[model samples]
Target: MRFLLVEDNAELGDAVVAWLSMEGHAVDHALTLAEAHDWLAVAEYDLMLLDVMLPDGDGRSFLRETRTAERLPVIVLTARSQVADRVDTLDLGADDYLTKPFDFAELEARCRAVLRRRGTPAPVVIPLGSALFDPSSGTLTQDGESQRLRNRELRLLEVFARNKGQILSKSHLLDRLFSQDAEVTENAIEVYVGRLRRRLQQAGVQIETVRGVGYRMTAP
Candidate 1:
C-alpha cells in the first residue's frame, strides 16, 4: 500500500515512515501543507496520515478543502485530545484520529481499519490454485514453495490478481502497471503479460489473452 505522511515533526515522521516501509508499504513524507498538496497532485495514494500543525497552514483546513474531492482514506495525527477536537476532525472528513506518542503497532492497526472501511485493503495472502500471493510484501509462493519475482513482474501480477476473472484492457493494464510519470508503450504491456502467463502457468493460473481485446485470469 502507498501512504502520504504530512508531518512536521522530523523524529515522529521518520519513525512512522520507517515502520510502515519495514512492513512493506511505500511512503512519502511532507513537512508542510503545500508540499503535501504538491505530492497529491501527481501520484496516487491509498491513505494519508495528516498532522494538524504545519508551517504554512493548518492540516484541518487542507482536509476541509479536499474532503469533497478526495477519495483516499485519512487519519489525523495530532497532540490534541479534547473531545471537541476529535469530533471536529471526524466531522471534517478524517476516517480516524490518532493522538501523539502512539505506538507503531496501534498505528498500523488503525491504518488497516480505515482501509477496511473503504473496502480497499489487500489480503495478507491471495490463494490462486496451488499458488499464494502475499500482496503486502509482494511475495508469491506455490505448493509450499516461494517464487521470486522482479519488481515490475510483482506489480503486474498484483494488478491482475486484484481484478481476477475480469478482462483488463491494455490501456488499463498499462496505466496500472506504471506510475503516472512513467512512459510505457501499449506494446510493452504485451511483453509483461506474456512473461506473467508463462510463470503463473506453473502455479496453475492462466492469464488468457482475449482476441483483440485484453487479458483475463482464469484457473487452468
Candidate 2:
C-alpha cells in the first residue's frame, strides 16, 4: 500500500516511514502542509498519517479542506491526549486519532482498522471452498494451515476478491498494485498473478485471463 505521512518531527517521521516501508509499503513523508499538497497532487495514497501541528499550517485545517473533496482515510497523530481533543478531531472527519509516544504496533493496528472501516465493505471472512479468506487481516486459512502471502500477492488477492468476475486490464492492475512512483513493469503484475494463482488453486478459485485484456477471479 502507498501512504502519505504528513509530519514535521524528523525523528518520528523517520521511524514511521522506516517501519511502514519495512512492511513492503511505499511511504512518502511531508514535513509541511505545502509539501503534503504537492504529494497529493502527484500521486494517490491508500491512507494518510497526519500530524495536527506542522511547520507551515495546522493539519486540522488541511483535514477539513480535504474532507470537502475526497474521502481520504486519515489518522491524526498528535500530542493532544485529552478526550475533548479526540472528540473534536473526530468531529472534523479524522478516522482515527493516536496520541504521541505511541507504540508502532498499536499504530499499525489502528491504521488497519481505519482502512477496513473506510474501504469498500468486503465480507469479514470469505469462504473459498475449504479455505477461509480474511480480508481485514489479509490472511487465508484452511483447516489448521495458514498461507503466508507476500505483500503484493495479498494485495492482488484482495483486489480480485473485491472485483470478483469483473475484467481487470493490466493497466488497471498496475495502477492498483503499485504506487505512482514505483519503478514497475506490466510484467510484474503477471508475476504476482501467477503466484496468487498457484496459491488459490487449492482454495477452489481461478484467475482467468481475458486474452488481450487482463484477468478475472472466478470460482467453480
TM-score of each: 0.70, 0.81
Once model 2 is optimally superposed onto the true structure by TM-score, how far is the C-alpha of residue 163 displaced, in angstroms?
Answer: 1.2
**Tens digit of per-residue lDDT, candidate 2, span 183-217:** 88989998999998888888788999999999988
Candidate 2: lDDT of 195?
92
Q: Each model's C-alpha lDDT?
A: 0.83, 0.85
Number of clashing residue pairs in every model? 0, 0
Off by over 4 Å in 2: 21-26, 42-44, 82-84, 116-123, 136-138, 142-145
Q: For candidate 1, lDDT tens digit of each residue in 1-220?
A: 6788999999999899888766645678898999898989977888899999899999999999878787779999999999999999999999999999899999999998899899985567887767888876667888677877766677678878888899999977765554343455888888888888877778889988898899999864
Off by over 4 Å in 1: 121-125, 134-141, 144-157, 164-201, 205-219
List all candidate RMSDs to the true structure.
4.7, 2.9
Model 1 residue 136 CA deviation (Å) reads 6.9
